[model samples]
Each structure stands twice: as C-alpha cells, then as structure tokens.
Target: MAKSDSVTRSAVLHRDTRFVPKKAVGGKGSYIFLEDGTKFLDSTGGAAVSCLGHGHEEVSQAVINQINQISYCHTAFFGTEASEELARLLTESTGGKLSKLFVVSSGSEAVEAALKLARQYFLELPTPQPQRTRFIARKPSYHGVTLGALSVGGHMIRRQPFEPLLSSNTSHVSPCYPYRGKKAGESDADYVNRLAEELDGEFQRVGPDNVCAFIAEPVVGAALGAVAAVPGYFPAMKAICEKYGALFILDEVMSGMGRCGTLHVWEQEGIVPDLQTIGKGLGGGYAPVSGLLIGEKVVEVMDRGTGVFRHGQTYQGHPVACAAALAVQKIIQRDNLLENVRKMGAYLEERLRGCLGDHPNVGDIRGRGLFWGIEFVKDRESKEPFSPETGVAFQVQETGLDPSHGISLYASNGTVDCTKGDHVLLAPPYNVTKEEIDIIVDTAGRVIEAVFAKVNAA
Candidate 1:
C-alpha cells in the first residue's frame, strides 16, 4: 500500500502512519495471498511465530471447537481442561525440571509475569529479603514491551521514547555476542568467563542483596538478530546469579517451542533457568498465546507461602488459545517435525553460507536449528557496518517483499550497539521442506545482490 490520500480517516493506529498497509486475504501451507493478489512465501514466520505455517486445518478446527464448547471464564473462578492439559504437556516436556507453567495472552504479558514471579518468590522465602528490588539484563537484547519487561530490556531505540515510564532499578551488562564482543585472541571459555565477570560486577554495583533477578534471552532475538550464546556462556551466567542469590531467567519468547529445533533453546545450552518465558510458536499464529514456565524452586516457595502469584490477566488462559496451541504442539510431535527442524536447520546453515558467504558486505552468518541471522557490513575485514542512515537491512527486506522477488523476512538493526548495525533473520516454519529452503535462500541472495548493485551505482 502507498501513502494514503485519506490516511486521517483510519481509526485503527498502525505501526507507521505514512502509508496504508496491504491486507493479506488468505493463506495455506507456506504461502499467504494479499488482497491485491500478490503471493508471498513467508520466510521469517512473521517474526518467527508461524511455526506450523499459514493455515493448518487441524489447528483452525481446534480453535472453532473450543469456542463452541466454552469461550471465556475468569481464572479466579474456574480452570478449563484445555489450559490445564496444555500446561501439563509443557511441564512434562521439561522432564519436570520446570514443574509448573502459567499461560498468558502474549509474549509481553508472559515476561511481565516472570518478572513479577521473581520478585514474589523472594518474598515468599522463609527468610524474606525485602531489599531485593533490582533487575540486571544484557544490552542489545529484547524481552517484551510491557513496562516491567521493557524496563528489563536493553534495546535502546525501543526504550528511548518510554524511558521516563520505565523503572530505573534495572541495569545492563554486555551480551554474549562473540561476533562483536569476543576479542581477536580470546578463547571461547575465556570470553564466557569475561561476560560472567561483567554480570557479577553489575550485581555488586547494585548491591547483591538488593538484586531480584538476572535475566537474558538464551538466543537474543529481534533487537540483535538470532544471536546464540558461546559454549559455556549460559552456565557461567547462572553461576554468577547463584553467587549473589538472584533468580536466573531465560526469555525464549522467539527462540522457544521448537523454533530452534529443541523444545527450548536452553536445552542446547548447559543450564536450566529458574524462570523461562515462551511464546511465538506456542500457538503457531493460530491464536494469541504465550507462557511463563516456573522451575521447581520458584514453585516450591510459592506453594509453601501465600499460594497466590498476585498477578492475573482476564485472558490469561483463554480456552480457544489453549486449544489452538495444544493442537499445534500435538501436530509437531506426532509428525516428528523437530527431527525435520534439525535436518533442515543444518541444510539452511550450509545454504546461507554457500549463497552469501563470499559477498563483500556479508560479515557473519550465525544461528542454530532453523533460526539464522545474516549480518551485513561495509567492510568484511574490519566488520564495519553500513550507516544506519542507509537502513540496509530494511532495504533488503522491502526489496524482497516486492511481488517479483516474493519473500518476507524479518529485518533488524542496531546490532553493533543500540544504533549501528544491520542484519536480517530467517526462521521459516519447522516443517519447511528442502525445496522451500532453496527458494528462500535463492531469493535472499538475489535480493542482496540487487540492493548492493543499486547502492554501488549511487
């Protein structure tokens, strides 16, 4: 859609005000059709949410059937079977490590729930530490948009407009970004230790007794692209949290629920978090759903104390959403899609490197499972990023979205700090085939080439 002549007539506020966005009319399998008849092969799953892809009839029917059975009920009154069973499935998947789960309406709410739970867990202890009030997070990482979640988030650009509204108790540390933070001569183990010390230093600065939790994304999502941790990074961070008695949280809103091949990204890492947040793939875009998975420690404390979380959302566990998400998970397990994710994920890494590895502007290609990120730079040797003014990542994304190129990817910037780099992410559905992978890579390659050709000409 172009700049609208009657933009003021629109009542609904869209992300951008300059243009009227096009409408997607229908979808099936790996494709969605726009009202204007343009077909797009969704490459990044609309920010990695559509794991099962466009329209899986089973999921759709599940939602309809749930609505017919029972639509809404306050959590304070009754607990529905759908939400109860979905919660059980999630907890069992963790092998009872995370003994309980709380369902919410979106990733942001799920994160907000985690932050609140962490604070309450401390107060519920036998010897309550009322001084624990601060949170420590990592830079260039995103959790969610709610006030508490945003306060913990370190994405500067997103936080700029709402800084006054965000809490001041939260501080940030260096992310485990090996591409940028790792020194030229440093070993992986040394790098992990260095990051651990930075986090430890922050806890000391804030007064360890005053800290409530240390949170981070296992695989940093949109704000920094799909950047995973180094070999021992997670374990090292968890140790630092233990030293200061702060809860450890892993926000996997975009990297959990089989998005990264395993059910949870932390499973690949060597640690289990005290609290975890998951969404995006939970309902496979069929319904609005997300969750906060509570580990045994947090659950045991709450159980022995007030026995209330002190938080509730009217739609915290909507029946339709739970039903849709349950159906989505069942399909993935029944069809063995995670095995496919592992196989295709390796192929995707190989193909991404094969297609753009030699490009002068390609700086790094890093990821795990079906998730990947391609960092762009002006000089590969120096790893110098393109000017933020160029908006290189968005340019590539928009060019690919054109009817001719026909691919939709997720674009991200400020990878260097909160304002300096560019990268695009690719997170196709978990069940995506080898042939579909070829088309996505080929389209991305061509789009990159065309965009740079024009830039060079200018």
Candidate 2:
C-alpha cells in the first residue's frame, strides 16, 4: 500500500487538504494501475472523461506528431491544420447546424465562451436588443466552474459559496428530472408542459425582451445523476425560447460527443439548439479540449457585424490538443464504438436492474448509452434521500475502491436538493465488453450492499 505521509508532503494543492489520494502510475483500457501494483476497474471513466480510455497509441502518436510539427500558435496570428481539421470534423458531426467552433482548453472555458457568444449574438443583430442580457437555465444542472459559467449553472451547493461573486443576470427553473420533479400521477406531457410554462414564466418575470438565452443539458449530469428529460420536454422548452426570441443553448459538456449513444443528444430531441457547448468526451481524456459550437443564425449575425468573436484565450486552439482530439474522434469512428456503446449500455442497464432493482435503498436507475446513475434513498416509496451527513454515495465509491472490490465509481450527492440525495454514476469506456459490464454491475451491487449494511449496523 502507498504511504499517506510521504504522499501528503507535496507542493500540489489538492482538492482535499485532509487526505492524499492514491497514485495511479499507469492505465490501459478499462483498468488503472497504482504504484502498489493494484489494479482498479475504471467504471466511471474518471468522471466520464476517458471515453477512449487510457494509453491509446493512436492519440498519443497524434499528439507526438503535432508537437514535432508545431505545438503552439497564437490564434490571433496564425491557425494550425490540427485545429482546422478538428473543427471541421466537429462541425460536420453536427450536420453543419453548428457552423462555427470555438475551441477551448476545458468545459468551463467552453461554457464561458457560450455565455459570451449568446450576449454577443444579440449585440450583432441588425436591430440589436442590448437589453437582452439575462440568461435562464435549469436547476440541478452544472455548466462549469468559472465565474460566468458558474453563474449560468444551477447546482445549488456548488454555487452557494460563490453566490455573492456570481452574476445576477442568470436565473433558474425546474429541470426535467422526471424521477423527482414529476407530480404523483402526472402524465409525461403534463409534466413537460408544466416545466415549459415555468420557463416561460421565468422569462416573463425577467422581461422576455431582456432575456438572451435559455441554457440546459439535454441529459442532466453530476447534480442530478444522469437524469434525462421526459419525451417532448426539449421541444417544449425550445418553443418557449423561440417565443421569447431567446437563444436555445444546450450544455452537452458531459453528455455530448457520443456519450449518449448518439453523436449529439439533441439529435434525439426534435429541436436544435442555437448555441451548444461540448467537452469531457471530446478528446476522450487524451487532452484538455472543449468547444462552443455556434449555430448558423449566431454565425450569420457575427459575420454580418464584426466578423469576429470578441473573445480570446492563449490556448484557444492548442495544436497538440486538437491533434489528440482529432485522432480520438477518428479512432472512435473507425472502430464503430458508438454501436458498442448502445449494445453494452443496454446490457449494463439490464444487469444493474437485475442485481439492484429490489435493493431497499435503490431509488431510481436512469441514463442512456454508457452514462448511468444509481440513486439511493432512505425509503424507496417516499423517495426520501439520505441526510447529507450520511455521505452514502461517497461511502459506496470508497467501498468500490477497496482491494476486495478493485473498482472505481463516480460518487455524487445533492441529488434531491442541494445536499440531501446520494448517487453513484457508472460510465465505463465506450468499448467496454459484456464481461466487463457484468463485473461493473456485480461490483457496484456489492459496494452498495456493503455500504448500506454498515449504515444499518451503525
């Protein structure tokens, strides 16, 4: 085992000051190896980032080649072929609906760019509505961590500490989390209509003419734990945005780039977004890359105005990052991994339900493709979440990593509200096999059972 004392004495400012994490020396495919030579099945893909898994030779070679050719070029001065190719592939994936791409280093930066572009789109219009400065997003949603992105995000616990510092121009409504948000006996259509009316009311309250955009995740991640909207929900919300002349923005940072079986989650939904943000799976953890995909309307407005987006980043289009992402995308297509994601996703869901469906604490199992969440509750019928102090999700995650389990799962709390619910997410690599899916489901069941047993014993 690795010694904590030796690892704690480091200059790196880690996420937790009280504890130092284990060192992962290497990884390949679905498993990561620690310095102690212990292996862990990467069930959550490192928070759903490593879609292609680790040590991909193709991606590594792409990065090496790009670095050998040209590593860095300021976007203002020169553009690189790597960046152009990556952008072309991404735009093409969207069927040219998103005609422009603004590549950035992280999901947070992509969100910040999207917010800025939304504001800029209005300013560039022939009859500019400078007053259209407010944004409406859904609660229990996460965009990113930067100030502007955080302002637009609706994850309450994440925003509480930064409340005073966040922008007041943003407002939030109920997310399309049917598991919890749907009223007893309410039909899906009624639930969607209610949420749509709520969004419309928010726009009216903020002055419809003053709203710039309505941003949402097609499938809510992190805060809500893989909660997908009910049928017709996106279309209803899009109608409200269109009625108010507001840009429809989809934050696909965690759900896009084939995470949801489809290349774009919006493709499943009937309507198209005016602005979109994608990351996490974009480079499949090969490099830190994310981007804002601008719709034709937004691009046209900018083209007719200044022909330039009033934003800049030093690493806006890093050649190495672009090259790695391009290679990852090519590998995904060449291997036909999305088909595997669908087949395995169905098997995983079936196995999870078969194993844990009747567990007393298992509240809801929901998700699509490789992204799935298992929410826990104090009482399944009541949907009563465990108190935040219980730390149920975290405990399950820790248990999964125990030597006996040798698995890694993504733990998240605040599923019921800002601090009351617990959930563990599973997002194995897109190419995970049936045997691996069985192991993941079996290990997950064991982890959940062990954690709850301890809670009961205590």
Candidate 3:
C-alpha cells in the first residue's frame, strides 16, 4: 500500500480509496501551505469556493465576533442577527423579489431545501396537478451530491453508482454546448433553438403537466468546466418553463457570487429563476454557508397555496456562517470587486490565449469572469478526447502541483459526454492580482505542455 493510503486507512474514509491528500497547514491570500511548507497557488479556489481567497482578516474577525455573541441557535425558535442582516442584504440586492432566504451549511443542503421547497410549492397549489412529479435538467450538469441535488444533477459518472437510489422522475436533455455539440453549418441561433427544441421535446415526453421544475446551471460548472449556455438559451428555457407553469431553478452554487463577474449569473443571461441555490464564494471559504433564494413568483404561489413552506434543518441559518458571509459580501460590494472581475477576466483570457492557443492537444479554452477551463483532445480536428483510462488530466494536475511549479488547479477526466475527455479548470480568487493571474496561466500552460509531451511520447 502507498504511504498516503496506509495513513488514511488507519484514520478515515477519504474520497479516493488509493490516495490521501496532504494536510493543509496554513493559507494566505490566494495560496495554501502544506505541512512541508511548500505553498501552492490556489487556482481553483478549492472548487471555486474561495472568492476572497484565504486568510482574510476581516472575515475571520467577523466569525470571531459572531461566535462570541452566539454561534449556534435553534432556527426553530429564534433567528440570529447575522442571519437576518445577511438575508436583508441579499434580498435588497435582488430587488426584493428574492425575499425569502433559507440558509444551510453546505451547497447540497441548500439544494435539498430548494427541491423540497419546489415540491412544497406544488403541494400548496389549491388544485395542484397530481401528475406534477417529474423534473427536467440538462446533461453535463452538476448541482450537488445529496440525494435531492443528485437527483437533479445529470453527471453520469457521479450518478451511475447511485442510479438505483435516484429518483426516476428526473430527465436530462442536451446542454447548450456550442463548441462540440453545434454543427459546422449551423449558426449560433440555430444551435440554441435546437437545444431549446430538445428541452421542449423532453418536457413533452415527460408530460409538461407532470414536470415540477426545470433545474439548470446558468453556467455549467464542475461537470462541463465552466461551460456557459449558448446565448438566448436561458431566455428560451425560462419561456418554456413559464408556458408549462413549471418552476425554474438555477443552481449557481459555483458560478454565482461574483465568480462569473456578476452577483448572479442569471442576471447576465437576462433571466430570473423561481429558485436559486448559491454557495462556494458565498462565504469566501471562511465558513460553511449556502442558501436558497426564492423568487417572488414562487413565493406568491406558496403564499396563495399554503401558509408555510415545509422544510427545516438543524444548522439552518447558523449565526457564525452568516456573519462570515455577510462580512465577505460587504467587502465585495464595498470594494467594487465585480468591476475588477470584468477587467481581470479579460486580462486572464488574453494571457491564456497567448500561452496555450496553439498547443497541439488543446481542444478548447472557454469560460467567463475568473472561471476558465482548458479541454484536451487527442485529435484536434475531430475533437477526439483521450481515453478515460489514460487519466491525462489527473497527471497534468499532479505535475502542476510539483514544487518547481507550485500551482494548484481543478482537474478532471471524462469531460466528453461524461466519460472520455480531460479538462483542467482554473478559478483563481476574484481578488487575484494581474501578476498572480499571469503566474497561474503561465504555470498551467507549462504543466499542460509537459503532460501533453509525455503522453504523446508514450
């Protein structure tokens, strides 16, 4: 057995059965330090969670203050000040339409609450359609890992093992992936319309009246590597949901909170969801926090139908998490960080193009704001992905973490249709400097080239 494996086997059940991660001893700004004092630039923000990066004195101070006041409180009995203030700020920014905020400890919990709230909204309908039990989602999408979130997620590999336990009421259609899915002769408009048609067909097949909600990531995260939908896709989707009287749930857990250069990605797409799940950068990784932002349309239905939304968690609206998130958000707004995201995002894109635009194995480079993805293909013309068994992306990631490079990233295999391609994801903190951005892209380019060369030689 490997040393890491032996160590983990004696202590815990880690995600990878064969490997154990090194202990993270400390962190500052946009880098994390390992036990051996080797530091890695946190390019992926620990899966796009650390927006403010690590070691923010302000966020840390806020958490400390909240804990001193009251860390835990039974939401069943009394709501805390921090939770109230955070909800007020969120609702205010959302223009009051997103009035109710249901806080949770993690993205999955928020998603679970969102799903239950959706189901409960239907229950409150005076003459609710009994057949409204199905859900419409898109493939190459990820919501979360809990049962409810997993039910809505369309990631084939993640859902495969739990297929038996997952709800059969869910249906997945093609994502609005323009790079690979769009035909050579088709225009962007036509490609979008085709995807809309596919979604419509799925809804019809599932029986429009039976579909409760259509859940999607405004910009697909994790699964497709920051794959934003084709222009006009979301408007078309929202219209369809409206026509069918179905709710729309946008899972912005990874793409929202300024990661996509906006407070909410749907704002950029010119659409609003009936319910939204947000996390990751919500608390800037200072504390565990996630939330369900309910739209006025859904609120109205619930208000008219039933007086109460039936769902609650013990740790819902924890004071310390709220305080930390509140402080983090205030800093974002107070500092006008969105403007920086727009400026830095363009710079990052240009640097990436300059560095890796013509690499032989690089298939596509795409993303928005600070989130970016580099896909690799064996045959560029055919966009043929490397075999999954090769694990090319994982190797590149491991090489990037070498002491000489000292860059960390989000990497994955099976990007092509969830079982064939490799991709390296970069989601540096929003507060990252131009120099840091250059270092991240340059290091990533070098590491990717090295891995590609090795693979080709083999």
Candidate 4:
C-alpha cells in the first residue's frame, strides 16, 4: 500500500531478509501511520527506544534550537551548554554519586565506554592495581555487538559465531531468572543467596584479586525478556563486588530513564552501581544518544590518580543529542510521567495476568513497571519449553503484526538460555493510557492464542 515494493527489490541488506517493513510516514501519540493511512500501536517503542513516544514537538524544537546556535563541536576543542546541562540533570537525578557523564551515539558505544572506563579505573589506580584485569558478567545477558561489549556478554547464540575473537578475561555466572532457575520450593532469599554465591564462585575461580568489575542488567531487556533481579539480589551482588575490590557496573541501556518505574532500576534493588550505562529512552528516539554515569568511588580513584579519563568518542558530547535528551528528561519530570509509569505499569501487569496468566501455553508473566514478558511453553506441568526449532516466538511476532490484527509486540527466542526458550516482551511507553494498555494486551493475546492453537493442531 505504501509502494515500497520497488525499494524492497533493491540491494539494501536489511536486518531481516524475509520481510520489508511498511514505510512509516508519520506518528501521533502512541500510534504510527503508514503512507496508506494504516495505524499501528507502538507497544514496544521500537525496541524500547521511543520513551517519549512518537512526534514529540518539544523534543524536536529543542533539537532545532541547539542546532541553530551550535550544530556540532569537537569534544576536544569545545564543550556545549546542552552537554553540560544534560550531565547536570543526570547527576541530579542520581543524587550526585554519578559525577561524570561520557556521552556516545548508541547503546553499544555507551557499553563500550563503560567497560573501558571500568578497566581504565583500575589501571589508573594510585598503586596501579595491575591484578585487577578480569571482568565478570551474568549469563543470558546482552550488552552490545561491539567487540568489548560482546566479549562481556553471555548470550551464547550471539557469542558463538564470534567466540574466537572474544576476550578470555571475561567470565559469566547465572542470571536471576526465578522461573527457570529457582528451585520448586526455594525461598526468594535462598534463591538470591544462591545467585550471589555463584557470582562469588566465579570471582574466586578467576581469582578475586584479578577481577576489575562485575556487570549486570538491573532488569534484563532484549536478552532475557525483561527479567528482573530478585529482591535483595543487587545488594548481595554489590556486597560481593566490594569484597573483591571490584566495581559494580549496571547496563540499563534498555531499562533506564523511567522505563522500569524508576529513574534507575538499581534504586528499586536498594543498591547503586558504580558505573551505569543509559540509552534508548534518554533521547526518546529523537536523536541517537547514550551515556555512562561514573559513581563517586570511581571518580575519587580517578581524581586522586590520573585526573583524566583515557577513553572518549568523537561525538562524546554532541550538542544536538544532549539538547534533545535534556528536553526529553525535563518533560518526563515536569509531567510526573514516572508516576504514570507506576500507575499504568500496575494496570498493564494486571491486564496481562488476567488475559494470559491462565493459558496453558503461557508459562510465565513477569517483570516490573512497564516492562513485562510472557514466556511460552510446550508442557506447562514440567515447565518444558518448546524446541527452538519451532520458532514459536517468531511466529507470534509475525502473526501479531498482521494487517488484520493491526498491533505490534516484541518477540524473543531463547528465553530459557541463549538458545532454548521463547517469550514475547511488552514495554509500552510510560505515558500510555489505561485504554492503550488494554488494547495492547487484547491484541497480543489474540495473536498468542492463534499461534498456540495452530501448534496444538499440529
């Protein structure tokens, strides 16, 4: 209908080869419109990037205003007011523990910067703690595709192809996935202790003295279907990191900036990460932007020693990006959108539970705030997952976006591990209304039922 068939026939190597996306011509509120005037609710915010939703005039105007004054300036020669203000807002939001901001153009860049900063922190120590060389992260995790971030990731499927090129200094422990990893009768406290112990063991195996930092997602986004760490998990993990003299780095690229009902997911866990990566929602998809907030301890080490961080990007603090992100952050706070995130998030969870909680194929409904995931299973009693060969998650994603359904939901495979289970994620915008939540759940439910019905028939 949009006449993209000709473009599809061209040489563009898209992310997927099977289908070409309908051209998005415009958007309003929560829905995107195509050239043919077809409207589809953007439930997942384009992989959780559009936090302010689409067509935010204020964000656009802010970007324009900054560009009019100073479109771009090299970080080496000059600093922009927009960049300075953005840093101030982030520092204020985090209560001043985060004193430094290293801006980049994408989530992967932010992750890469965080990792480099973590390792560099040790290298620049007064005593030059050379033994602090190892990095520890959790399994079933995703940081990014760049070499450094990829080296630290635990998604086997994504890592397998590049295993030879990955760093040997990185090690992984189990994720805090209660549905798959928790024992049948185990208490939450016990489960958390078990995970902490596992993390400690990995540190010991790698020689605790050699560990530089421990990285994890406060609420895992793409890699684990929005799985959250259990209560007290971060506190325990933070304690272990302290024991080993290791810094705590949390990757909140897809879960930060009020998406998880808080400014930072670690706040809910009752612990703060020493270095945190934030993206996606920061610029609200207006411009590509991501940044790392360095904690006071790390700042103190740098301040006492080298007094200058070693890593930076050409676009480390782009004025336009900073301006757009500043506007998005201000608008969110000004409107008290986080409160709506909490209220609407509760409604979303309830709606998801009421709609799909009892389905035999629906294995789990879990997450916090607006970030929710619905895992699928082949056998509910045994908690057995469908074979990856079936591609159940992909089927659900495809059918859910059919023109007849006119809805979109995020789908993911390998929810159990890096290659085993399947689930679909729903991360609607923080400002989503109750009616919007209902529509998303209802439309997604129909798609799930249709897919499983065919699976059962076969």
Worst 10 residues of 1 by lDDT: 1-10
For model 3, how does the per-residue alpha-carbon lDDT over 73-99 read when each residue is reduced to its tens digit?
A: 898899888999999999888888788
TM-score per candidate, chains pooled:
0.98, 0.98, 0.97, 0.97
lDDT of 4 at 333: 96
Candidate structures ordered by lDDT, highest first: 1, 2, 4, 3
Worst window of 10 by summed lDDT in candidate 4:
1-10
lDDT of 4 by residue, 1-458 (tens): 11245555757665666545677889877888876667988898988888878998999999999999999999989999999999999998889988888899898998888888888898888778887878999888999999889999998888899999989999999999998889989999999999988998998898999998999999988888988877888999999999989999999999999999998888888888899999998998999999999998899988898788787678889999999999999999999999999999999999999999999998899888888888899988998999999999888988877777766678888778688899888888778999999899999989999999998898
RMSD of each: 1.2, 1.3, 1.6, 1.7
lDDT top scorer = 1
Evaluate residue 391 in candidate 1 and report its C-alpha lDDT on the 0 to 100 scale.
Answer: 92
Cα lDDT of model 1 by residue, 11-87, tens digit: 76877875566778999888989876888899999989999999899999999999999999998999999998999
Q: Which pairs clash (backbone N, Cα, C closer than 3 Å) in model 4?
A: none
Error of 4 at 203 (Å): 1.1
Task: Per model, state how many residue pairs clash.
Answer: 0, 0, 0, 0
Candidate 3, position 408, lDDT: 75
lDDT of each: 0.91, 0.90, 0.87, 0.88
Name the regions of candidate 1 deviating beyond 4 angstroms.
1-9
